[model samples]
Target chain A: MSSDRIAAAFARAASERRAALVAYLTAYDGGFEHSLSCLLAAIDAGADVIELGVPFSDPSADGPTICAAMVRAREHGATLTHVLSLLAQLRAQRDTPVVLFGYANPLLRRGATRFADDARAAGADGVLVVDLPPESAAILREPVRAAGLHWIGLVAPTTSAARCELVARGASGFLYAITRAGTTGTALAEADSDEDAALRRQLALVRAATRLPVVAGFGVRTPEHVARLAPHAEGVVVGSALVEAALAGPSVLGASVRALREATAR
Target chain B: MLRTPVDHRDDDAPGSFGRFGGRYVAETLMPVVLELEAGWNAAWADPDFRSDVARMLACWAGRPSALSPAPRLAQALGTAARVWLKREDLNHTGSHKINNCVGQVLLAQRLGKRRIIAETGAGQHGVATATVCAKLGLPCVVYMGAVDVARQQLNVLRMQMLGATVVPVEAGSATLKDAINEALRDWVAHPHDTHYVIGSVMGPHPYPTMVRELQRIIGAEVRHQLHAEVGKAPDALVACVGGGSNAMGLFAEFVADATVALFGVEAAGCGLHDRHAATMARGSEGVYHGMRSRVLQDDDGQLLEAHSISAGLDYPGVGPEHAWLHECGRARYLAVDDAAALAAALQLARSEGILPALESAHAFAALPEVLATLGFDRGRGEGRDVVVNLSGRGDKDMPTFAAQLLARPETP
Candidate 1:
C-alpha cells in the first residue's frame, strides 16, 4: 500500500464527516467461532476498520479489561496464526481493513520478516507492535515495509515534538494519538482544559510532524467526543467505545457507530 | 566535604540522570509510563510530599537505625579505614527492601490503585510487599520463583500471614526471572486498578527509574550523616549489586563526586572461573526484561543461567544504568566468590554482633579490594573511610547459615 493511498483514504473519510469506527476484538475473545462471529458482526455494525488483537501472555501497557480479555483469548488457545486465519475469514466475507495489535514479544519470537510475511498473506493491511516506539523501531520497520504492510505508530499526550518527529519520520499508515496518559479500555471524564488543550496541541504537532493521517483514540465513548475531535484529526479511532458497545449487544454497537458516523459527518 | 551531583540530576525532568536514565518502553505504553514520569517528577519537586514520605520512613519503619563506626571490623581487615554501617537491617521488615516497598505502596494509594502485584527472589521483598499491603488495606499478590518458595519457606509463610497471595512460578529456571514474568503478566491483566510494585531497580521504563528514585533516600540520609560526623565525604561508597537497587541508592549522591569512588560488587558464586553468573565480570550485552544491558548469555545469544549462593544475586542481568556506569567508568564492579562472602557474613557475626545477609556479604567481601587499591595498610590510618551498605540483616538466612555451618567439617 502506498503512503498516498493511505492519506487519501483518511482524507476522504475525514471530509465526509464520517467518523471511522475501529472495532477492536481479540480473536477468540470468547472462542474462535465466537470471535469470528464478533468480527463479522462488528463489520455489519458499521465498523470501518477491524483491529484484530493477537493474544499474548504479556501486554506491557494494556489495562485490566483488555488484558483479561487477552488472557482469556490465550486460554482459549488463540495464537497469532489463529488470529490471522480469523482475519483471512473476515477478508473473505468483507472488505474492511484489518490491523493487528500486539506487543513486541510475539513478533520477536517469530522472526520479524517471517511474521510480517505471514501477516500480509493472512490479509492484514497493517500491524501495530505496541512496544516499538521511535527509539526502538529498528527491529520492525524494514521487515514491515518489505512485507508490504504498514507499521502504525502511536503518539501519546506526553510525546514531545522532538520524539514525535522521530516517530513520524519512520511511521507508515495512520498515526494513533492517545487521548490520555493512562492505559487502554478506560476513558477519563471529558478532557479537562489542560488535557483537552494538550490533546489538541499534540494532534496539531503530530499533524505537522508526519505526512501520514493521524487518528486520535482513548476514552472516546460518545458522539460529542467524536464530533469534537473530528476537525482536528484525520480520523477518530474508537476501540473501547466500540467494544463496550458490542458488550452492550450488537444493536448498541450499531447505534453507537451510526451516531458517531452522523456526528463526524457534520 | 565532597561535592556530589544530585544537584545536577535535577535538570533532567521526566527522566535522565546525567545520561543515565530515560523513558525506553514502546509506544503503546508510553502514555501511561509518561504520565507516571510526570507525576513522580512533580512529586520530587514538592517538599511537602518529600516530608510526608520522610515522616512515614521515620515513624513507621523506625529510621536512623544506627550508623555505628566499625573501627574494630575495619582494623582487623587492616584497612584502618573507619567503616560506618547504616543499619537498614533494623527496619520493620529487617531490610532496606521495606524502604522502597513503603514508598511505592504509598504512591499506589495516592494513585487510587487498589491492588498491588510484585516479584521476589529471597522472599525479603515479598515479605516487605506483603507487610505494606496488609498495613495499607490493599490487596496484594506476590509471585515467587518455585525454587525460592522452597528455599525461603519462612518468608513464604510470613507473606501468607500478612494476607498476601503467593504464586509459585515454575518457568525459566523457576527463579526470580520467572517470578518477574508472572508478576508482569498479572500487571498487564490488571493495569487499571493494580500497580506492579517492582522490588528492585529493574524492569521497563518508569519502573527502574521510579524504584531507584524511591531508594535514593538511602543516599540522601548517608549524605547528611557523612557530613555531620566525618567533616568530609567518605573515600569510597560500596554496596552489593544484585539488580543494583541498594548500590544505586547508596551511590546516587556520590556519582558526580570525583573524589568518592563508587564500587558495585557482584556475586561470583564459587569463582569467576567457575560456571557462575557474573554480569559485571563476564557477561555480554543482551536484552532481557525490556532493556539492553549486561546479561549472562552464551555465544548463540541464549541467556546463560546465572548461579549465586545468594538467591538475590542469582539474576542473570544487571540494571541498564549499571551497564552505562561501567561504560562511562563512573563506577567499578568487582566480583566476590561464595566462600569469601560466606566468610564475611560469619566474620561480621562474630566481630560486630551483626549477622549480614549472604547477599549483603558480597559488599563486605569486597573490603579487601578497597584496602589494596587505596594504599591503606591494615595497620595504618593512611586510607579513606569506607561506607559498606548493610543491605539486609541475616535473619532470613539463619536457617541456611546454620545448616551450612553445621555441615562444614572444618567448623569447630
Candidate 2:
C-alpha cells in the first residue's frame, strides 16, 4: 500500500537518528503550474513528506497567510478535483509521500468513501482534515483506511490525554502534533524557552497515547525552531513558513525546506 | 501544555436536531469547546445559574418585551387575520440579541474567561455583545466584516461607545461569514483567556443549543402573553431567518404545538434569480462555520457570497436547527426581496408606528405570503391571529432609509 511509504520514510529518518521534514504546500495556491514547480522543488530540497493543502474558502482555523493564499487559490479556480489531478501529476515526477490536507466541507460534499477512492487513485498516501475531529470523523476515517491509505490523526496542545487516546486508536500514518492552540501562521516567541518545554510536555503525552510516528507542527518556522524541537518528535511539519517561502519564489521555498531539513539532524 | 478536558462521545448527538447540529471545529478548538459544553450543561443544571440568568434578563435586558396588537397594520392588510407584534424591538439593546449575549457573557465570567469576542454582520449583535460585556466588566472585541463596518458605521460607533474594540475583517466578501471566520481564528489563538459569545444559533454544538435556550424566552413569553390576551395560542408565528436566531427563539416553544403555523422568512435580496440570501430556497447540505446545515454554495462546495439589503440576513448559511426544521417540513420557509422588505418597513412605520430593522422587515414582507397560505378570510371577517417577531428597532437603518428617500423623486 502507498501508506507504507509513510512508515518507510519515518524509518529512513529514524535510521539516521534525524527527524523527517514534513512540508506543507497549498496546491494550486499560485496556480497549478507554479504549485507543481514548488512541489517538485520542495521534494528536491529534502521534503520527506508533502502535505498538499487543498484550498478552501472558509478556513476558520488558518491564520492570515494561509487564508489569503487559499482565497487566491480559489480565485485561480482551485477545486478538489484539480488538487487530486495535481497529486497525480506529482506522482508522475516524484516518489515523495504526500498527504492531502484540507477542511471537511469539500471532502464530505464528495462523500467520504468516494474521496478516499479518488485520493488513492491519484497517489495520495494519507489524508488530514483540519476540522473533522476523531469524534465526528469516523465515517471519513473508515473509508480512508479502507482505501489502503493512511488516515492522519491530529493531537492539539489543548487535547486532553483521554481524547488523545481516542484520536490515536484507528489513526494510521503519523500523529500530527499541533504545538500550539492557535491557527497555522502564529509565530513562536522563541526556540528553547518555556514554550518549548510546555510543547515537549504535551508531545510526551501524545507520544504516550500512540505508537504512531508523531510529527509536531503549527507555528513551526525557522531552522532554529526546528533544531530546538527536532530531538523530541519523529518529524517536524513546516507549514505557513514554507508557504511564505514559495510566495517569495520557488528557489527560496526550496532553500527554506533544505535548511529546515538540515536542522532535523539529531 | 494547554490541555483542556473533553468528553468525546458519539457524533451527531450533542446538539443534534435529527442529524443537523454537530461539533465540527478543529482539534485545536475541540477540547475547549467540549469544556464549554460541560460548563454550560453544569450551569443549566444548577438552579442558582438559571436564576441569575433569568434575573439579568429581567433587569438588564428588559425582558418580557411587549407583544402588542398592530391594529392599523391588520386594517391596512385588509385581512380578517388580527396581526400582533412581539416587540423585541423594545428590548434594551433594540433587539433580541441582548438576551443571548447576557447569558453567554455571564457564562464567560463563570468559566473564568477574561475577554470576550463576537462576530456581527449588522451591528445589532455586536452592540448587544458590547453592552453586555460593559455591564459584566469584561473586555470585548467584536469582529465585523469591513463591508459591514462601512454600511453599519453607527453600530461600529455604538460598539466603541460600549468599550469594545471593533476589528474589520477583510477576507472572503467581508461580510458575516468572514467576520465569523476571523472570530474563530481569534478564539483559536487565545483559547485560554477569551470566550466567543456566538451571536447566532449557528457554529458548533453547545452554542446552538445554548443560544436557543437563552433566547427561548421570546417564544415562552409569547405563548403566555398571547394565551392571556386571546385565551389561546395564536394561529401563526413569523420571524426573519438571519442565522435564524430570532426565528428559532420565536418558533422553539411553539414547535410542539402542531396547531400554530410557523413561518421563517429569508432575504431574497433583489430577486430570487438575482443576488439573494435565500439559503433554504437555493441551497444545499454543506458544513459551514462548524455546523452541518443548509448553505448557499457553488458547485465545488465553496460557499457563495449571499446578498441581502439587511446585513444581518446576508449570510451564506442558516442555523442547523433551521435546516432540520426545513428538512422535516415542520415549518415553512419563505423568501422576501429587498424592495418588498423596504416597502414593508415603511408600511409598518406609517400604519402601525413601528419601524422595524431591515432584517425583521423581511418577516414583515413575507407576512402576506404567510397569510395567504394560512387560509385567511378573503371576505375580511374575523380570522386567525398572526404574531410576528419584530426583532429590532430601525434606528440603525435610517441611513439606508434616507438614501432610499434621497434616491426617490420628490412627490411635490
Query: Best candidate per TM-score, number?
Result: 2
lDDT of 1 by residue, B17-128 (tens): 4444444465534555655556666776778777877888888888866777887788778766788787778888988898889878887777778889899998989999
Against the native complex, each candidate's DockQ, computed on alpha carbons, is 0.14, 0.84
Candidate 2: docking tier: high
Pick by DockQ: which candidate is best?
2
Error of 1 at A177 (Å): 13
- What local lDDT does model 1 show for residue B39? 64
Candidate 1, TM-score vs. the true structure?
Answer: 0.68
Q: Of the true contacts between chains A and B, what fraction does model 1 have? A: 0.21
TM-score of 2: 0.97
* lDDT against true structure, model 1: 0.76
Per-candidate alpha-carbon RMSD to the true structure: 8.5, 4.5
- State the lDDT of candidate 2 residue by residue for B333-382, as single tens digits: 99999989988998899998988999999998987787778767363537
